[model samples]
Target: MDTTQLKHLLGEMTRAEKIGQMVQLAGEFYKEEDSENTGPMHEMNMTPKKMTVSGSVLGISGAETLINIQKEHLAKSRLGIPLLFMADVVHGYRTIFPVPLAMASTWQPELVEESANVSATEAAVSGLHVTFAPMVDLVRDARWGRVMESTGEDPYLNQLYARAFVRGYQGQDLKNDPFSVAACVKHFAGYGAPVAGREYNTVELSERTLKEMYLPAYQAGISEGSKLVMTAFNSLEGVPATANKPLMRETLRKELGFEGVLISDWASVGELIPHGIAKDLKQAGELAIQAGVDIEMMTGGYLNYLNELIDEGKVSEELLNEAVWRILTLKNELGLFENPYRGANSELENNLVFSKEHREKARIVAEESIVLLKNEKQVLPLTHHQKVALIVPEDQSKDVLGPWSWKGEPSESVSVYEGLLNHISKEAIVVKTIDHSKNDRPKDWLDDVSTADVIVAALGESSYMSGEGASRSNIKLPAEQIQVIKELRTLNKPIVLILFNGRPLDLTDVVQDVDSILEAWFPGTEAGTAIGNILYGTKNPSGKLTMSFPRAVGQVPLYYNQDNTGRPLTAYNQEDKYLSRYLDVDNRPLFPFGYGLSYTQFSYSPMKVTLSKSEREQTDKIIVETTITNSGKVTGSEVVQLYIRDKVGQVVRPIKELKRFKKILLEPGEVATILFELNQQDLEYVHQDLSVSVESGEFDLMIGSNSEEVETTTVYLELKKNE
Candidate 1:
């Protein structure tokens, strides 16, 4: 449908029909039994007629179910407008991949893009129109359960991932592509910085901080042509984002150039009442429509009260028409009018869902996402001849497919014990599947542990421990699991801790008990196969920490790019009382961001910096080059990171900020000169007044394996005078 057709559809819609287009409901509400005024329908005061015109249905997939529902809905519709189906296809639909946090650790946007394309392919065939994914919220606090959904804390990396995800999900032609699904970048404004890392908590940040730190990723998604944007549950500066007009309209829509449909997060529009901004659902609907929230998900705030508000002149008819128009435009763009079933086909779904080709891609992605945190005296790459004890909770392996994998079956996931059997003989490996929660440790378990030359202890938080409302105050291994590790340490055997988790955990105690630690963060369906390959030298671990692993839970919001305080503790003033030092612990993370170990080592030579001109203009580029050599005797991959520190700024700057990074694969004794180019935009920072600026001053250009361990060189930037 063209613009003229969409306008005609909008004009043909009645006041109530237009209001219905701004409402979204779950799959259960579309059932034949729901036609009667009872259950959720009665609760939301929705009539049979109103249900026929709902703009979208979420949490519904599978080609057969959606076809039946859409057939039923269009049959009852006066205008024959099809219902849009959306779901939270965060990581995958059926062929599960690692969580977004794990994907970010790979630092390979192209690979991430491929994973997303696979997800879109599966989801499109499964009857999904939009996927609320590429959750580009920049998360610093690992205590926030939703950190597993975001790319990481860095804006530059998040921006790269956001664009990649949008490109992959929407493809080159979203409207014409059957394999692609419209991507919805979520929680638009400061959703990740919830106070105390608690879910749905208030977010208090300066406008400058919000734009500088959180908004870039969402902006990147929009710039890459994501079709939809979802609002955050948290309030920014006492205004809930669903009802925050300046944020949704001014910053997101106008400044960021997001002309796409803006939908509220699940029940967020109705949440404005609890947020103290609305007296009732009517007021909530008024504020949301005013704030430019086109669709209210899982709530009847728009359907129940939008018409009344419009009748009372509290909400404009123009706003209602615009929202409905956008919804119609999206349906048209999806080619729903021509073929309401889009790409949904049960036959295609069966062939594509968790197919061998898709699972292979998942295994490859999961392999790159496993970070080797510690390898003392080269304890890893276990020999097949040696006896190995695989210590794990009986049911923990099934939880490898983490949260938001609505369609993935845990039973299909490969277990760690099974993964080991792929490489090592079953007779040589003893699997002690003990319940970690049990108080009594069997004598047989201890005897099995004593017999092994090396203990591969598989442990960490379960799928339920992290992701959406699973925030924890103590971000560490459970006490029972810690005690089990402590007891195993007495065996005097080399211990390899294979951690399965969603976020960066405080590993202060575990570091002492284990000789090697492999951070295998919920590696989806092929979890065991990927870890097995890495453990047996078939594959090298190249993943790095996207978020810092705090040494203690007290450093809840620890990140690499933190601003240096006025009283920052320096090496010379280490013992100073007034400095910014922790009284009980060191002010360093267990492992810094971009910190990961490989089976082989790489060394970097002194960096060389060259300016395009001696007195560089803002348009001229600055080139930095460094030679990285595979110093060890085995092939490996390394992520060479480039960071910049501005000596002076209008506002205080972070100690260092990651600007560019490249992942290079090198053979034994191979040397490669890595080069990076930067301009004034790379050096720009958000000021207190919310204006971005790049000052003329010296910047410390640092290159290294990680954020903390870097070699530095100084360069000056002199901007040309304005005419």
Candidate 2:
């Protein structure tokens, strides 16, 4: 339909119908059978009329189900607008890949884009028009369970990944594409930095800090043409994000230039009541609509109270019309009127869902996503000839897919045990399950543990222990698993700890005993194949940690980039009592960001910076070049990272921040020169007064294998006036 037809449909819509168009209901409400009213719908006392003409449905998929619902919906409406189907296709749909955290470890935005393309292809065929995904929230506190969904801690990296996701999901042309689903960049404006890392807690940050650190990734998604933005569940400063007009309307729509639909998170509009901002549901509707939320997800705030509020002259119909117009335009853009089925085909779904080709891509992603954390005395890449004793956690098989599996089945996932079996001879492997519930050690288990040439202790938190609503106060391995590790230590055998988890864990206690550690964060469907390949040296582990792993829970918000303190901890002042150093432990993460070990070693030459002129101008660019050699005997890949520090600024600046990085693969004795270019524009930051500008100053540049270890150099940047 054209703009004229969309306006005509809007003119014909009654207040009730218009409100329905702005409200999104759950899939259960539209089900043909199953009269069981679950928590959300029953509590809202949603009317039947609202259910029939609802604008969209959430958490529903499949061509048959969506087609039946759309048919029923269109038949009941005077002016038919087919129901929009959406689901939380966060990672992948049916063919699950590694979680977003693992994908970030690959440091390959194109690979992530390919994964998203496969995800979009699978999801679009299954009848989903939108995916509430590519969560670009920059995370520092791993205690937040949703860290698995985010790219990582750094803004630049998150920005890159967010763009890749948008490109992958929406493709080049959203209107003409059937394989691409509209990407919804979500948790807008600081949902990641909850107080004490609690879920749905208050996010308190200065406006400058918010703009400088947290808001870039969301803006990047918008720059890449994301079709929608989802409001975060947390309250920004004092205002709940859903009802914060300043943020949702002024900063996002005007300042950032986002001209798209703004949707509330699940029941977030109603949640404003408990947030103490709204007195009742009516007030919630008034605030949300006024704040520029075009769609309400799984809530009756719009359907129940929007029309009444408008009738009372408390809310304007013009505001309601604007929302309805955006919704109608989206449907029209999706070509729903032209084809109600929208590109959903059962035959395509059957062929593409979890196909061999997609699984192979998943295997490649999984292999690159696994991080080799520690390999003491070169104990990793175990030969197949070694008799291996594998001790896996009780929930190992069940939790392979991690959280947000949605349509993915655990039965389809390959566990560590299965992967080992596939790699090594069955006779050479002795498997023992360590029941996390019990402390008993059977004689057979102890006998196998002592006799085997090597022990592979596969342990981690269960999938349920992380993700949404699964925050933990103590981010450590389970006590039972640690106890089993202690028992394994007695045998004096090489213990390789393969950790399967979502968030970064406090590994200070366990790392000392384990000879080698591979952090395979829920390698999805091809988990076994990827882990097996990495184990037998068929694949070298090239993954790096996106988030810093803390040595203790006391360092809850630890990260590599931090502001310099007045009393800094220097080598000369190491014995100074007043220095900003922890007495019990050093102020360093257990594993720094971008820290990962490889089977082979790599060496870097001194970095050189070449400026276009001796004195730089604003337009002048500087080229930073470094040579990396595979100094070890084997071929391997290394993630070369570039970090920068501003010596003096208008305000305090971080000691170091990741600016650019490159992943290079080198054969033995082969050298390659990597280059990164930067200008004055790249060094700009938001000042305390909300002005964005770059200061002329001296800066420190460092190129490193990881955040903590680097070769340092100094450079100066000066901006000259345009002639």
Candidate 3:
């Protein structure tokens, strides 16, 4: 539908009907009989008329079920407007892929895009219109459970993944693409950096810091044409994001150029009352509408008080119309008027959901996302002749599918024991799986460990340990698992620790107890298969850490690109007490960002930086070149990272910032020349006044395999004279 048609439809809608379009309810409201007046309807005082005209439904999907619901909803609609179906399809729908953090660790945005495309295809076929996914929050704290949803700590990498997710979900032409679902980039404007790494905690960041670090990925998502933006649940500067007019209207809509529908995260609009900013639910609705929140999800704040606010002149009719207009326009853009059932077909859902082809893609993604953290004396790639003992401290067969997998069946996931059997002969490998909560070790556990030539410990947090409202003060392996590892260390056999987790952990104690450590973060449906492939050398581990692994829990919010302190700790001042160094623990992380291991080794030549012109414009590019050689005896892939350090700036600059990176496959003894081009925008920083500008100065251009290890060369940026 065009603007003229949308305007005509908007004019025809009554005040109640228009307001209804701006409210979203859960699937249960529509699925159950409304005449009963029970459950959510009774709690929210919602009327049957309100349910009939609601613009959108979330937390439900199924081709047949949605088809029935849509038919009933259209029957009651005065204008026959279709209901939009949205769900939290964060990682995958039916065929679960690796969590977003694991996906980002691949350092391959193209693969991430493919994974998201598969998710969109499966979701659309199941009758979902929007997926609240590609959460581009910049996470530096592992204690925050939602870190599993974000890309990583770096703004540049997050930006790449954000665009990839948007493109994958919406496809090239959303209006004509029935197999694609509209992407909703979520938790806009600093939702990741909560205080104490706690869920829904307050975020206090300076405007400059927020713009420089937290806002880029969101801007990247909007620039890539994501159809919807969900507000964060946390408050910024004491104002809840759902009710912050300056943030939603000025920063997001005006500055970020996001003209799409802005929806509240779950019941964040109603949460404004608890936030102490709004006196009651009525004021919460008033403030939310005033802040330009187009849709209130799972809340009666908008439905119960929006009309009253308009009647009392607290909220304008123009605001209500604009909000409803955006929602209607989105529905039109999705081609819902022409086909309310978008891609709903039971036959297609059965044929496409968790298809063999989709599972293969999931396996490939999971394979690439498995990071090899430690390999002492190359104890991995176990020989088939040697007997192996697969000891799992907990029953992790179902736990392989991490959090937010509402539709995924845990029974379908592949366990490490199952994966080992695929590679090693069943007779050569013994398996001992026990529940840690039972406090009962298998009677044959020690006997199995003593006879095995090698031990593989599959352990980590459960699916319930991470992702949203599951934050932990101690981000480490449980005591029982650690004790089991320590006990296994007495066997004097080589131990390989395979971690299935959602976030980077404090591995101070476990690193010493294991000969090899593979960080296999919830490898989705093909978990066991991917681990088996990596373990047996069918696939070399190439995934890098997007988030740093801290040595201790005190370093909760650790990252590579940190600014220098006035009194820095250095080799020259190692003994000084005045320096900014911890007395008990080292300041550096146990493993830095871009840190990973491959079966083969990669050596980098000295970096070379050349300017296109000595004095160049802001848009001119600077070329950086380096050569990487696979110095080891096997074929492998390497993530070559390029970083930059500004000598001086308007504001203090980080010690190192990741500007560009590439994952390249190299044969044994083969060498590849890597090239990266940087521009003035890469050096730009948000000043104290919140204005982005690049200063002309010297920058250290560094290229390496990871953040901590680099070969550096100096380059000067001489800007052209301008008014």
Candidate 4:
């Protein structure tokens, strides 16, 4: 269908039908014979008439279910416009891959894209038209449960992953591609940085901070062709993001060049009433439509009062037509008019749901995502000959499929015990599975631990402990698991801690108890096998931390790129009591961002920077290079990270910012020279008055494996006058 046909279809739609096209309801609304007074429908004041004509449905999949729903919706429609089916196909569909946080740890956007492609393929076959994924929210707080959904804290990394996900989900063409589904980049404006790390909490960020730190991720995704944008639940600068005109209209539409549909998260449009901005649902609907929210998700505000607002002169008919036009345009792009059931195929779904090939890809990604956090005395790479003592909780089936793996099966997942069984003979290994649900500790396993050479303890938060609606004020290991570690610590054998979590944990208490620690943030369905391979050295651990692990919960929002305070804590001022130093704890994080250890070691030589032209020209390029050598005895990959700090700026600058990085594989004792090019414009930041410009000053360039541990060198950057 072309523009003329789409416009004709819209012209034929009634006022109610046009408003219905801007509403997306749950699948339950379409299932019941009379859904008007059922459950939350009556509470939201949704009538049965609106339910029959809703433009989109969410949270229902499977080819048969969606085919039936779409057929029913089209049958009821006067214009025969098919309803869109969308879901939160975040990480994976059936063959669950590692969570997005773990995927980001791999430092490989291509692999991340592959995982998204597999997810889109699986969901598309299940009859989903759009996926609200590649969240792209820059998060610094581990306590924010949705951190699992985001890539990491860095804007550059998040921007790269955002683009990769968009490419994978949308592919070359959404209409022509059978495997691809339209991507919806979500939580439009700063939903990740909720105050107190609580879900749906208020976000108070300046326009400058929002542009500099958060908006780039969403900008990158939209620029890469994401079809839709979801409004956040939080309020930005005292204005609800669902109805913030400056952000949704000016920044997103005019400045960022996003011509796609804008939808609300859950019932955010209706939430404006409770947010104190609107007095009633009628005003809320008007504000949302006027503010440029194209769709109201899971809310009846648009259906109930949007047309009324248009008649009362609160909203323009042009605005309503524009919103409906975007929706109709998307429907045309999805080829819904030609074939409503685009990718629905039962046979294809059965064959591709959890194919062996997809599982292999998940295993490969999980292997790269498992970060080795600590390996004191080189206790890892446990030989098969050594008798193993595995102490894990009994209810470990769901641990593999962490939160947001809504379609993942716990029974189909391999447990750590099941994976380790293949490597060690049954009689050679002693397994002590304690039922954590009960209060009792298994003292009977002490004898097995006394005889074993090494103890591999699998412990961390449960699947529900760290994803949407699961924020934790105390982001520490569960007390029961910590007690288990303490009991194992009484013995002389070295303990290998394999963590299965969704967010960065406070590991200060147990860091010393375990000899080796692997930060495996929910390695999806093949979690057990991936851990087994990395433990036995079949696959090397190369993943780095995307978010900083705080020493304590007090440092909840900690990151390496923190602002330099007036009273900075330094080596020379260690004894200065008035300085910005903690009285009880060190200011450093337990594990800094980009910090991870490999089975093999790589060392970086002093970095050298060369200027291309006069420094004043912001477009001039500067080349930075360093020699990296694999010093360890095994072949491995290293993520050589480059960071820069503005020595002086108009506004206070961060200690350092991650400019660029390279993931290189090297043979034992082999050396390679790595080069990174930086443009003078890259060093610019948002000034106090909101202008962005690079100041002529000295800058420090650093290169290292991680953020905290790096070798620094000085370089002078000049800003030339206009040509």
User: TM-score of predicted model 2?
Assistant: 0.98
lDDT of 3 by residue, 1-723 (tens): 888988999999999899889889888887656553788878778888777888999998999999999999999999999999999998889899999999999999999999999999999999999999879999999999999988899999999999999999999999899889999998977999999999999998989889999999999999999999999999998899999999999999999999899999988988998899988899999999999999999888888989999889999999998899889989999999999999998999999999999999999999999999999989988878889988886556668989988788889988887888987788988777757777657665698679989999899989889899989899999888888898899899999999988999999988998999999998898899999999999999999999999999998799999999899888787888988888989999999999999999999887777787643344277899999999999899999999999989878999999999999999999999999998777888887887777777899988898999888888778854233
Off by over 4 Å in 4: 32-35, 45-48, 440-442, 614-619, 721-723
Instruction: Give per-residue CA lDDT, model 1, range 1-723, as digits (tens).
Output: 878888888888899888888889988887766665678777688777778888899998999999998899899999999999999999999999999999999999999999999999999999999999879999999899999998898999999999999998998888789899999999888899999999999999988888898889999999999999999999998899999999989999899999889999999988888899999888998999999999999777888888788789899889988888888888888899999999899999999989999999999999999999999979998888889998887688688999878899999999898999998788888888768658878665788678889999999999999999999998899888888899999899999999989898999987998999999998999999999999999999999989999989998799999999999988788788898889888888889999999999999999999888544345378899999999998899999999999988889999999999999999999999999999877888888878777778889999999998999998877854323
lDDT of 2 by residue, 566-622 (tens): 999987887888988888888899999999999899999999998775443443777
lDDT of each: 0.90, 0.88, 0.90, 0.89
lDDT of 4 at 552: 92
lDDT of 3 at 577: 92
- Quote the RMSD, in angstroms, for model 2: 1.6
Tell me how far the alpha carbon of residue 58 in candidate 1 is from the true structure, in angstroms, after superposition. 0.5
lDDT of 4 by residue, 1-723 (tens): 988888888899888888888988887776756456678788767877676677888898999989998888778887898989999989999989999999999999999999999999999999999999879999999999999999999998999999999998888889988898999998889999999999999998888888899999999999999999999999998999999998889989998899999999998988999899999888888889888999898767788888777888879889989999999999899999999999988889999989999999999999999999999999999899988898877777457888899799988887887778768887877888877777766567698778999999888888879899999998988888888888899997899999989999999989999999999899999988998899999889999999999999898788889899999999888888998878988999999999999999898888888888754444378899999999999999999999999999888898999999999999999999999999866788988887777777799998999998999998877765323
RMSD values for the candidates in order, in angstroms, are 1.4, 1.6, 1.5, 1.7
TM-scores, all models, native as reference: 0.98, 0.98, 0.98, 0.97
Candidate 2, after superposition: displacement of residue 338 in Å?
Answer: 1.3
Q: Which residue pairs in candidate 3 have backbone atoms (N, alpha carbon, C) closer than 3 angstroms, thus clashing?
A: none
